[model samples]
Target: MREGFITYKGRNIVFTDYHTHTNNSFDSKAIMMETCQKALENGVEQICFTEHFTLNPNIPTYGHMKWEKYREDIQTCQEAFKNQPLHILKGIELCEPHKYTEEYKQLFQKEHIDFILGSVHNIKDIGLRKTLAKYSRLEAYDLYFKEMLLLVEKADIDCLAHFDLIKRYSKEAFSQDDFEKFEPLIKKILSKAIERGIGIEINTSTVEALQEPMPSHYILTLYRELGGRILTIGSDSHYSEHIGRGIKEAYALAKECGFTEVSIFENRCATFVSI
Candidate 1:
């Protein structure tokens, strides 16, 4: 077992990382087996492969993921770990889910997907980096959150990933105070998510690159204040070396924000594990 896991209700809580990618994802170089092994080595008992699945033509990873091949790889990994300590789930992290309702409707019919993560990686058909250069810093942030609100309402997703992704590339520096401007919209998104039984993801990849989680501590506090409790922590690791990275910190932040349990999904059904 991984050491230093947080204890709640007189038991140690093992975290499940729900957002991950493998070589099937266009931008990732991590092999599926290697990623799984890394997660197991880190003592992550449950790991979901939420690979990038996008319909946006402009996305570099748009047509890269082949459903059958990806499914086959996951099946192989599942068989390899069947009697092992880790639980592997098939998941997809879809970009701009609000834009392709019909496509997703058809895709899921044949896919054995367990969990889906909705993300807004573009604005007006442009990718994040270009979009940031196209608009003012604050405008870009507004655009990102505005679309997120729409995504929560329109997409059939299990959770929202990387809540404030726009900040990842903004030229202008930002801080928690800037989050105030979008609080109302974010609250609306959270309300819609709760109403729809969708959860929010705490992506920990940002901890190494930005020294903060995508949603940041302020946003999490706001989520708790709004009575939002369904949360999932993800490393968002694109490589084996980074798998399960920063997840413990993410879980600790969740606990600090008044969350007692963290969410995990199996065959699209969400269950809570005490933090």
Candidate 2:
């Protein structure tokens, strides 16, 4: 199980896991309200239910959710937890924005989504998990970083989820040399993310599950060097036990990266909370 903590800012901020999946996502097994209820019990002030939104033509689960049903589930959770201290926000973890822009836009237009996390789970017909398993470690790292740049260049979403998630499965392939090789692409993505007013997520779930942080120190340093300021911290928890995991470490890393403010999104606009 993963541990949780209060943020460094001392806002009584509680913990907010912005990236989470429920049964709405094909790969997740937890139900929507059950996850939100767990957040409440864990003292998480806010939780964003960002179920997966895949667009790969080869995947049977692509476009698995109906917006109407998703909206209904969110509404049910809201009403059920209204008097509770926890605030649940509707969100989606978009996989490969270049392939599903229209579908994403339509969902955003119709739903009162508080946040949207852009993720590159699929690249050139390769899913992150599959890519790591099928290719050499260095090869997969290169592909992941390259596609991450592509995602940033093409998507205009709130924040980038698990910026170094490919490493979760390819840790054995990572090294100072690999980081150096991908530094340019990392910097490029951060620069573009800044230009587009998008925030990057300090995904703590990676640390909890993979034993290594996302946007590892090297990438975080590169982001700071490129004047990337906006950042959001998320646990990316799929189950109750993982809620609020590693959030304090995420905040500490952000501060170490010279970020004075952490970002939160509402109505698709970012609000910064000073650390």
| Clashing residue pairs in candidate 1 (N, C-alpha, C atoms within 3 angstroms) | none
Best-fitting candidate, scored by lDDT: 1
Output the worst ten-in-a-row residue range by lDDT, candidate 2: 1-10
Off by over 4 Å in 1: 1-13
Q: Which candidate achieves the best TM-score against the true structure?
A: 1
Steric clashes per prediction: 0, 0
- Model 1 residue 73 CA deviation (Å) reads 0.8
Q: Rate the local accuracy (lDDT) of all candidates.
A: 0.84, 0.75
Error of 1 at 207 (Å): 0.9
Q: Write the per-residue lDDT of candidate 1 for residues 100-188, one digit (tens) a residue.
A: 98899798887878889999888777888888888887788888888999999899888899998888887777677777887888888
* Local distance difference test, candidate 1: 0.84
* Candidate 2: residue 184 lDDT (0-100): 70
Worst 10 residues of 1 by lDDT: 1-10
